[model samples]
Target chain A: MLTLQFLPYSEIEPLSSNSRIRKILNLVRENKIVLMEGRLKPNEETDLIQRTMENLSKDFKGIELCTVYPNVKDKFLKGLLVNILIGDRTGLTVVGPANIVKEIKRDPNKILLLTENVRRKRKK
Target chain B: MIIRLRDFISNVFYKLFQQRKSLKLGIYGPPNAGKTTLANRICRDWIGEEMGSVSKIPHETRNVQQKEKIKIKHKRKELTFNLIDTPGIATKIDYEDFLKFRLPQKEAKKRAKEATKGVIEAIKWLDGMDAVLVVVDATLNPYSQVNLTIIGNLAARNIPVLVVANKIDIRKANIKKVESAFPQYEVVGISAEKGHNVEEFYESLFRLVK
Candidate 1:
């Protein structure tokens, strides 16, 4: 039942500007759960989350938003990404791509947004 | 056979005696969301005693609070109510301050991490309840993490929710804006301090429970 939607870092502005994004933002404004994906520089992620909260507070009525960070294998990167997703429900788990993992581990609140890989048994 | 029959009769009597229903109702909101205020109101009105403390500081009711059973009669029906007050939902916690709140270090750390977790738990708890009342601050911006999370989760579960817009006595309180924000909800604006609109709230609750 879990749905995954991916948005690359470069497309964030256009995605956010889209009317669909506004509708989703309104859902967040109304205190609904939303999962966002993008490649964000450590600092940019933090600033963007904070700014989004501030704007939502001012413009929306009776809505609240929370962000979750996914924890990948790289502790440092995970920490950085985790920081960006703070102030909301986040999951922690190891994922693919060490560089992305390092960014995610930097932030504390990010949970592993990705599903775990299962190891298949080798035939004797 | 005579002894066995007597024992069975006594057991039936005991079972009848112990059969009492207490409706479980949860009061949830963010820090300073007026959960305690509402708890106090219910206690004073129904039980004739104020059981919970009210404070301006957020997270005053850090621990889950349960009031003594209260009995009220509406439309000739008798009901026993047990109200539970929960900690305010917040995005982040200052670990040091949380520690100073007298929670054991280990427990505080766990709870600190569960700030969002607590909100989720509160939402899940609402699933089995007879009704849920989501309190919002009328004086502050209607939108915030606690308000939305609680409402959204409850709505998703299809639980009957009653929105209480607290602190209406303040000059800046905007009842209309709060209502507009939750257009699909049955929102009632009231000042918990002065007990304004409280009767209507109780009446609405009676309708729901009935």
Candidate 2:
């Protein structure tokens, strides 16, 4: 069963500055696809991507970030277009494909586990 | 009768093709800020008849009050504006206030939260509007949750806004303090009842829409 989620880009805040990669890693493990929609600062985008790479397991195929431009119409991209205030400025839409969506749903708790583990590491 | 028949047919065709254009304007402010009075005055003046019932009770407009297709002239051009009037955004409603409304304890608590949520939703709905008119009571202190939230959200979204300090006819009306509070935006003072500065209100609106 496919579940649809509307994740606001503003909700993506850096848990800590210890390791940018760990944060994205944690997010991907729990959710099928972390839909990154919103105007992200340069540093924020870098941190998100790094964290995603670190957290993704070998079984995880790959993560794809889809960018949907404003006022453009393509039938193929219609379902994925999510109107969101990106980076607190520009408005844009985003859509992710089935495989990436599936991965996030399969193991929702992985994100919490990864976050907790990373927090412990930071303390040490 | 041929001319009459042609006119009738054209009218039908025009009705079929005419798209309904509604300019959504949200009226928002704090409790006892005379938000309802302003809404009442606008509705009265637009239709030349009263539609929204006026009241002194705070939160009289508990949910969004919507009046559709109100016609206004701007720079010799006529336009339809839809007015949405909303409840005052007070800090979390205390249990006692909720109980005063005579709701069961549980329901009252739920309703209190719902009211706050409604205010937030109203602000969110303003995203696509052509303009927002933030109604502030001239007599009241300017520092308030609703005033700050509505103004800040509109500024953040870059939505065009007009701050109206209503009830200026009251002896207590302190329009200057309200004006100073929002230096970035020009504040217009008006008595929604006596129709004072009403023309100026429309003029400012004309400039905005143009």
Candidate 3:
């Protein structure tokens, strides 16, 4: 009898920024609720949102985004005040399937996650 | 006659402003036990909107969702409360499990981190709760470690608890198993999603807060 060998090294793959996005999406897809730390820069956050919206299609249920900032209410000027105070300390959370995060409902940040099929209980 | 008149006025004053003290009623349970659904049902009937979203996924409520000042009126008896929907509790959370949903490596890890933090937040919120509704899925076994831990915490804090046996609409649902598991606390059986027997749930709430 000949011996056979099987090895799986999938978990060892190095993580990247894109892979990070993929991982977060993977969590949402599996119906697992996740809370991500750290915020993308304001420009980066907007870019990500724009890119996601531009890429949306019929196959996705959309993604949810919730951003948190220091609870500061001070604004001295209409447009110039925000530039001084919101100096990159803000953080954001993106939740949804990898394919459809753009389709998330409401403010993505205020959303709570639920697996797609877990919602089968009848409602009144 | 003067003594009786004084007692009557004092009682009326107590009945008006004092009866509506804002009690914070936190809704706690394991995943997908219809906590949010029940909250939404109560709000829609009174507040005209749902509290938060509900879905089939576990931890759909990762944060503590709040809908304040819901006044329940039943047969002229009334109660005012702030309803809080807390994130589902679990013994373990792994990033790899999230990968099963086809998420990539980074996002799954991020979610796992957030979820771990969320669990801590839920536990911390316990101190602020005046009473809690321990929502449980009637279709599953009720003797799990998660349920016991939740009940244990509530007991330790002396917080008033009412066990909600949710999902009675399903054929497999068994409310008695839940009741037997936590015989110390009163259990109310109702389908949060289908809106069946919700009036009974409200009646139980008035009793819990009273």
Candidate with maximal TM-score: 3
- Identify the runs in model 2 with alpha carbons over 4 angstroms from their true place: A1-124, B1-21, B49-51, B74-77, B98-114
lDDT of 2 by residue, B26-101 (tens): 7777666766777788788778765455555445556777888888875687777787777775423343455776
| lDDT, residue B29, model 3 | 85
TM-score of chain A of each: 0.27, 0.42, 0.40
lDDT of each: 0.58, 0.58, 0.66
User: Which stretches in model 3 have alpha-carbon errors above 4 Å?
Assistant: A1-124, B1-20
TM-score of 3: 0.57
- Winner on lDDT (2 vs 3): 3
lDDT string for model 2 (A1-124, tens) is: 3323454645554334434334344454444334444434433433333333233333442243333223333543442443322223233322223233321111111211111133443697
Q: Per-prediction TM-score of chain B? A: 0.77, 0.76, 0.87
Across B1-210, the per-residue lDDT of candidate 1 in tens digits comes to: 999999999999887654436677788887786878888888888778886777554455666767745787766777676788776765334444466667787875565444434444554455566568888989876654346556766666666788899998889999888887678888888888789988788877776666
Two-way TM-score contest, 2 vs 3, winner: 3
lDDT of 3 by residue, B1-210 (tens): 999999999999887765458788999887788989999998999989989988775666778889878888997998888999988765345566678877788987776666655665677688889999999999987764357557767887789999999999999999988887788899999998899999998899888888
For each candidate in turn, the interface RMSD (Å) is: 14.6, 18.8, 17.9
Deviation (Å) of B125 in candidate 2? 2.0
Model 1 chain B — which ten-residue stretch has the worst lDDT? B115-124
Ranking of models by TM-score: 3, 1, 2
